[model samples]
Target: MVDFIVGKYNYWIYIVLMMIGFYAMIGKKNLIKKIIGMNIFQTAIILFYVSIGCKKGATLPILGHAHGHAGQAIQTSAYINPLPHVLMLTAIVVMVATLGVALAIGIMIYLKYNTLEEDEILKAVK
Candidate 1:
């Protein structure tokens, strides 16, 4: 169990970060704080995905090494998987777009009520 945890420290870190973000998103009363928490959660998820593409002693998945001579075969295990990293890049763009929309909504809410608090907004709405 200790070996598993030690070997997968990135997962542990990501989990901790995700939990913190989850807590902030649910526990905070302010709309802006919730948005910040969402950003944190997005970041943790991206890092976790990128980490999944990494290997301990692997190189990037560059096609055909320029310096390698003929008859020398490249081992697949020596190269890190690039798919997760590519997917995470797309995820980051989506996260940014959503965050922008959320912030815009938050701004509108604040402009209307002069407060970013969820409870205050609810009371004002009522």
Candidate 2:
């Protein structure tokens, strides 16, 4: 069963990392730890995108028609999906934005209660 599952999808490593990051984010109570978890999650997403863009047998996506060097038009048959790359790029940008905002909020929360613990902050708030 393990071999069959591994053979079906070679990207299990990325999936595992993503799950770890998700688990950290959910399991941590400290705001800083949560942010680190978020960063890990984002990195896992980037890795997943890069893995998806990998093809078993394909040339780089660079066209070279200007220098009279005509080998064969880059094979389009084995080209990996570019959509994942593009989406990952957008997701990375969004992750940065979210991190920035989260940091700002964390700092504000710290200032208000002088604590990094979520439970402490809630207790102080109440």
Candidate 3:
């Protein structure tokens, strides 16, 4: 049990981050807080994916020159998988775009409603 917990500490950290974000989104009343929570959640997911793509003592996926020229057997397990990292790069771009749009929308809401609180906005709307 100790080994399992110690070895997977990153996962535990990610889970805690996710829960914090989830609680902020669900329990907060302010729109800005909710948007921040969503960003935190996305960041946690990206971190989780990036962490899972790593391996113990693994190098990059790039093939060394000697292996290709000398006809040496390429050991697949010696390299870390690059797909998750690549996907997370794309996700980071998307996350930034989403954050910008969300902030813009929040600004618009604040301008129109004169407040950033969801309950206050609802009351004004009603």
For 10-52, candidate 1 gives per-residue lDDT tens digits of 9999999998888889999989889989999989999899888
Best-to-worst TM-score order: 1, 3, 2
Candidate 3 per-residue lDDT, tens place, 12-124, comes to: 99999999999998999999899899889999999899898998889987776765557766777888989999999999999899989989999998999999999999999
Using lDDT as the measure, the top candidate is: 3
Better of 1 and 3 by TM-score: 1
Per-candidate TM-score against the hidden true structure: 0.88, 0.79, 0.87
Q: Cα lDDT for residue 82, model 3?
A: 90
1-126, model 2: which lDDT tens digit per residue? 988787646468777877888987999899999999889888888987877787767655454464665755555655666777888889999999999999999999998899999889889889
- From the highest lDDT down, the ranking of the candidates is 3, 1, 2
Given candidate 3, what's the lDDT at residue 18?
Answer: 93
For residue 86, model 2's alpha carbon misses the true position, in angstroms, by 1.6
Pick the winner on TM-score between candidates 2 and 3: 3
Clashes of each: 0, 0, 0
For each candidate, what is the lDDT? 0.90, 0.82, 0.91
